[model samples]
Target: MGETSKRKRKRNVSLTPEDITKVFEKSMERASADIAKLIEAITGGDAMTRLGVELEGMGLDRMQVIRVAKYFGNKPNQLHIHIWNGLNDSYKPDFVKAILEE
Candidate 1:
C-alpha cells in the first residue's frame, strides 16, 4: 500500500566526512606495505648508492619518495607516464627506466 505520511526521523546514515576518513585510513594502511617494499628495493645493499643519488637528484625527500613508490607500485605499468608527468625535468629518463626495470 503506497500511503505517504510525513514523518521526520533521524536515522543512522553514512556521512561524507566519515566515509572519507574510513577510505583514507584504509588506503594509508595499504600504502604502508607498498612503501616498505619500495624502500627495501631502493635502499637494499647493491642499489643503495645509485638509488639514493637518483632520488635525491630529483629533490624528493624520504616520505615523498615512498609516496612515489607507492603510486608506482599501485600501477607500475603506468610508470612512464608517472615519471614524466610527476617528476617534471628533475629525473633522468634512463635512471627512471633502470629503476622500473628492477
Candidate 2:
C-alpha cells in the first residue's frame, strides 16, 4: 500500500478562462434552482412578499426556517413544543406536510 501510494501519478490539465466561466455559470444555475425550489416550498400558496416580510425581522436562516415550518405547520397552530430536538431536519415542504398531518 505504501509503495502504491508513492507511485501515484499526477494528471495535469489546465482550465481556460472560458471553461472556468462555464463551470461557474453551471454551478450558479444549479444553486439558483435549488434556492428557488426551497423558497417555493417554504412559501407554497403564500406570496413570496409575505415570507420576505416575516423573514425580515427574524433573519430566518435554514434551521430557523425549518423550525418555523415544523412547529407552525405553515399556518398558526396551538401545539407549542418549546424544545428544539433537531428533528425538523426534513426539508421545508415535507416538514410542512408532516406538521399539518400531525
Best candidate, lDDT: 1
Q: Show the colliding residue pairs in model 1.
A: none
Flag clash pairs in model 2: none
Candidate 2 segments whose C-alpha is farther than 4 A from its true place: 1-10, 45-102
Model 2: how far residue 58 lies from native, Å? 36
Q: Which parts of model 1 are misplaced by more than 4 Å?
A: 1-15, 45-102
TM-score of 2: 0.38
lDDT of all predictions? 0.56, 0.52
lDDT of 1 by residue, 19-71 (tens): 89999999999999899887665544233344445566777778756654554
Residue 26 lDDT, candidate 2, scale 0-100: 100
